[model samples]
Each structure stands twice: as structure tokens, then as C-alpha cells.
Target: MDRPTRWTRATVYPDMWVDPADDPRNSDGVSPDGELPTLVDYLGRYRATLLMKCDDLDAEQLARRSVPPSTLSLLGLVRHLAEVERDWRGWITPGAVPPRLYGSADGDFEGAAPDPSLVARAFADLAREQAATDTALAAHPDPGERLGADGIAVRELQVHRIEEYARHCGHADLLRECIDGRVGQ
Candidate 1:
């Protein structure tokens, strides 16, 4: 029986983006053993993935919407994630958190206009917030450490962060593909 073989996103490439030896996100034989390392490693990888998805794109491409009604764009995700990181910093640290990066409720998405300065600012904010969040998290090494009045464990929050990044990275994958038809891990 003769049949046609259709190439899809999955079967299109056994190795999605690049060769294993050349993949920057590769663990490089340093396997994370503890809960903290594992969670942080995952979070870092997802963060890197999102940045990689946005790489080489200009302001217009980065701000391009996924669909007509949806405001899901790579730049928007970056801003949203920056907001999330800032929020997380507020939770973990005992300092007065700054106001939202974008003033409006939907500013993260709606405010992601296709401007070169806005794109630069968004990436800069993301990096700054992520570094601050990482530093705050580092101060409390114990997984069982509680945060805020709700008593959410540091471990739990870390897991939640990983989940958040994972979900958004998926969105980023789609958004990037929509912009340039490039697909991979």
C-alpha cells in the first residue's frame, strides 16, 4: 500500500532547533540533583527558550500579534514575564514593590506597540527583574522557607514559576512560528 508521508511540527525534526552538541540550553553533563537545582535549572532553561524564540526579530516582528483578537506576542510575553518576576520579588523580598511596568491592566499585551524603544525597554526590564528575582530567591536557600502570610513554601513558588515559564514558552513558540514559520524546541 502506497501512502503519503506528511511532515508535521513534531516529525519535521527529530532534533528540533539545533544539534545536541550545539544547543546552548543543554545541561552539559551537569545534572541537577537537589530540588532547588532541578527547579532553578528548569526555570532557567524555559527563560532561555523564551529569549531564544524572540532572538533575531525586530521590533515589529517581536510585537506582531498571534491572531486577530488575541494580543499574544513575543514582546508582550516578555513584558508580562517581567511583571511576573517583579511580582514574585514582592512576594519573596521585604521591600516596597514598584508599580507595574505598564500602567494599564492589559498594558503588558495592549501596550506592546511596535516600537524599537519599547522593544528595548521590554527586554531590559525582563532581564533586570529576572536578576533581582533570582537574587531574592537565592537569599532563601531552604525549600521549606515560607513566604508572606499565606505561608507558601519557597519550593512551591519555584515550581509555580517553572509552570508559568513553561506555559508562556509554549505560547512564545506559537507566536514565533506565526511571525516567521520557524518552529523548534
Candidate 2:
């Protein structure tokens, strides 16, 4: 069997705006039942799509800034997502605080650079943080559980995660296009 090719920003998209299940509508087959898993599934799919868009590019390409003064890059987005996941976990997991991955607060955006190693590290950190968040969510399925001192509900956090992924995925589309001619999601 042939091995699956790694994805890259230079690669043309197979299709655009389809859900993870390959359905035409982004929300198709999301979850007819109710919230909970539906929200998690949507957010997870968005996060996966964003990473897929970045797949196979070299660290240099991943770290390439969109434009001067923007400091936005595929790597930066990955790093930022790692921070977001960690932050959410910290809020929800009570006393199970995990140390920040990108140094101090705002470090994800602050420490971003065009360095190859930094880019690679950002991707790795994202993977780790994502795994931790999934584990936390699985361990606590109740959507009504309050997260953080702000008293945000688990369901609300999941919804916020979906919003975060959608917004960043949109940014990823533009950044990937800027890096190369490849377009669509």
C-alpha cells in the first residue's frame, strides 16, 4: 500500500469548506443529538483542519510571517493554540494546572520568530497541549462543570474553543495562501 503523502501549504486542497466527514456543509452530521460532543467534535475538527493546512511544510515555511509587522505565521498559530488549550485546561481542571508551554504569558506571540527549531517546537508543543486538553475533557464529561475562577461552564469553554479554531483557521487560510498559491480548506 502506498503511504499517505504529508500535507503542505503548497499542496492544492482536495476540496473546500467540507466538514471532517467530507460532507458539503461544514456543520453537516455534526451531532443531531444535542450539545456536548457536538461542540467538541466541531472544535476538534476545526483544529485538525488548521493543522492539516500546515502539514508537511518545512519549519521555514511554517514560520514565515504573513507580512511585515504582522508577526503571524503558521508556526505562531500553532504555538498560540497550544497556549489556548493549556489555558482552558488550567481553568477547568482545578488544581491540575499545567505549566505554560511557551514560557510566560503572551510568550506564544512574543517569542515567535522565523527560526526553524522554534517552529518545530511550536508544532510539537501544540500536539502535546492538544492531547492534554482532550484527556481533561474525557475525564470530565459534564458540560455544566464550572471552569476557572470566572465560573465559565465546560460547555461554554467548548464553544469558545470552536470559535477560536474557526477564527484561527480562517487566518490559517490567508497565511497559507500568502505563503504559496495553495488555497481552500
Candidate 3:
């Protein structure tokens, strides 16, 4: 028996919102040129992609779960990434710090709700953590430099963050498409 082939509407717009040649986001402007710059660029792109997925959505839409028995939502993704950014920052620059952003539990996802305030706070926290992480890395240019008590390499931390953002961005794509008919690659 011939199995049914699967096709996705996600690629219906092969250009992905705009012609590749005219897309400003893909433009390699006067941005820095180096390994660090490349890694940061990819990570930043994924971060922006996630936010784009959450665009045009109200708190309720964002907080709506895609399927039952799962806590996953656009808002939850934002909160979880905020927590992840903070954790990665701590790994690279652990020191006298303030209290936890949302306590030690799974507050990130657990607290994600259909509240406008929570949505705003999650975005703010994500931006703050990402900036701090960049500043910390800039102060220590050596990617191979061991950091914190564990002596983890800066490269490992940076790579991990990129991977984290990439993974979540994929999830965001699915969640957004489910919320609306909008789809992309």
C-alpha cells in the first residue's frame, strides 16, 4: 500500500513573508564580523522570530493552549525563554544577584497566564537578561574562557543559548500557526 504523502502549507510562501533579496532582516549591514558576531546574529534572529510569532496577539490569545494536557502556549514560551536567558546569564556571570525572577519553582510556565501584565513582564525580563548576557560576554571576549565556579567554557554557554532559542522558535512557529492560519518556514 502506498502511504499518503504529507505536505505542509507552511512552505506555500516559499519566500517567507518577503522576497529574500529585499528582506532587511537578512541584510548583513554594518554589523560586526566575527565568530561571536555570527553566533549572536543567529541567536538574535531566533529571538526576534519568537517575538514575531507572538505579535498581533492579545494576552488571552497568547495564553491559549494549543492542545489539552499541555501547559505550552505563546505566553508560556516567552516566560520560559526569559527564565532560560536568566539561567544562561547566571552560568556566564554568577555573582551577587537579586532574588529569582519568578521564584525557584516552575514559575515560568506555571505563572504564564492570560494577564497583560504578565505578558509585559515576561518580554521585559527577556530583554533585560539578553542584554546583560551580551554585556557579560563582551567584557570577556575569549569564548574559550572558563567561567563561574564550574569553569564552564564561554563558548558552551553561548552555543547552548543559540540552541535554546532555535528550539523554542520552532515551537513558537507551530503555536502561532495553530492560533491563526498564518504559517511560515
Candidate 4:
């Protein structure tokens, strides 16, 4: 039996998954102006990068736990990020308190089975949650504006979200590479 050729970090350019010019995560020539715009841009780019990593993969590929001892998958990441977005919305909106989308804290990963419907639902949930969170964030034009009873600044939460996305995006890159040899920006 013959195996398919798989590209690895050694075969590809060092550190980059794609060419810089062709990378979808690349920001346009215009830089984001303020703190809020910068934060939002970073978050948005990370989200897109995660999606790009999952693109062209089947449900089984998306849900494959390529890394041993870890239940992490591209599908799981999608579900987990959706939960995170919803949680962030609840944190910022007093009395919102949205229930967990996947029931248990680890349900996102544990329940990430290789089913097309499940994969579709995960993506849908992520998109809806992201839109809702963005809308909630839009209500606070001022980054310094305090939110919720804990009175965390909008800027603080935004920065945290960006950090979360950045971490997960790195995970997605590795998972994607494991699933397929495809690597670039």
C-alpha cells in the first residue's frame, strides 16, 4: 500500500502555513485605528484563521483526535469557541446569563463526534454566537466603559477574547496539519 505525500514544517517554509501575500488572515494595508478596532481586528483574524484551517476537511477529519491524550479537534475548537463567545456575552451583559451551549464544560470536546450534522451545527452555533457577541460589544463604543456587576472594562474583555482566539488558532494550525499535509500562512 502506498501513502499519500504529506507536507510538513520541514517541507514548507519555516513557521508559515501559507504565503504572506496569500494568507487570508492578513490585514489590509489600512491598520486598525484605536484600541477597540485593533482588538476586534485581531479577534476577527484569528476566528477566520481557525475557519480556514477547518476548510476542505470532512466531518471525520474535522473531528479526528490526531493528538493522543488530548480530545482536541477542529470541530471541538469550533464548538468550544462558540461557548466562549456566548460566555463572554453573558459576562458583559448584566442579567444575560446565557446557559452553556454544550451542557458540560468539556462537552464541546467530548461530544465532538465525526458526524456531518454535528459539524454543521457547530459551525452554525459559532457564527451565531460570534454575531451576537459582536452586537453586544457594539453597544459599548468606549473601550473604557465598564460592564457587568464585576465592572470589568470592555477593553479588558476584548483583549482576553483576542488572547483566547490566538491560543486556539495555534492549536487549529497543528490539528489541521495533522489531518492533512496542507500548510502555509
Q: Please rank every candidate by lDDT, starting with the best.
A: 4, 1, 3, 2
How big is the RMSD of model 3? 4.8
lDDT of 2 by residue, 87-108 (tens): 8888876686777787877678
For candidate 4, write residues 24-65 as lDDT tens digits.
777668888998998999888888888988988999999999
Which residue pairs collide in model 4, if any?
17-183, 17-184, 17-185, 18-184, 18-185
Q: Which scores greater on TM-score, model 1 or model 3?
A: 1
In candidate 1, stretches whose alpha carbon ends up further than 4 angstroms from where it belongs are 1-15
- Structure candidate 1, residue pairs in collision: none
lDDT accuracy of residue 58 in candidate 4? 98
- Candidate 4 residue runs with Cα over 4 Å from true position: 1-15
What TM-score does structure 1 among the candidates reach? 0.89
Superposed Cα deviation of residue 158, candidate 3 (Å): 0.8
List the global CA lDDT of all models: 0.85, 0.76, 0.76, 0.87
TM-score leader: 1
Best by lDDT: 4
Question: Which pairs in model 2 have colliding backbones?
Answer: none
Candidate 1 lDDT score relative to the true structure? 0.85
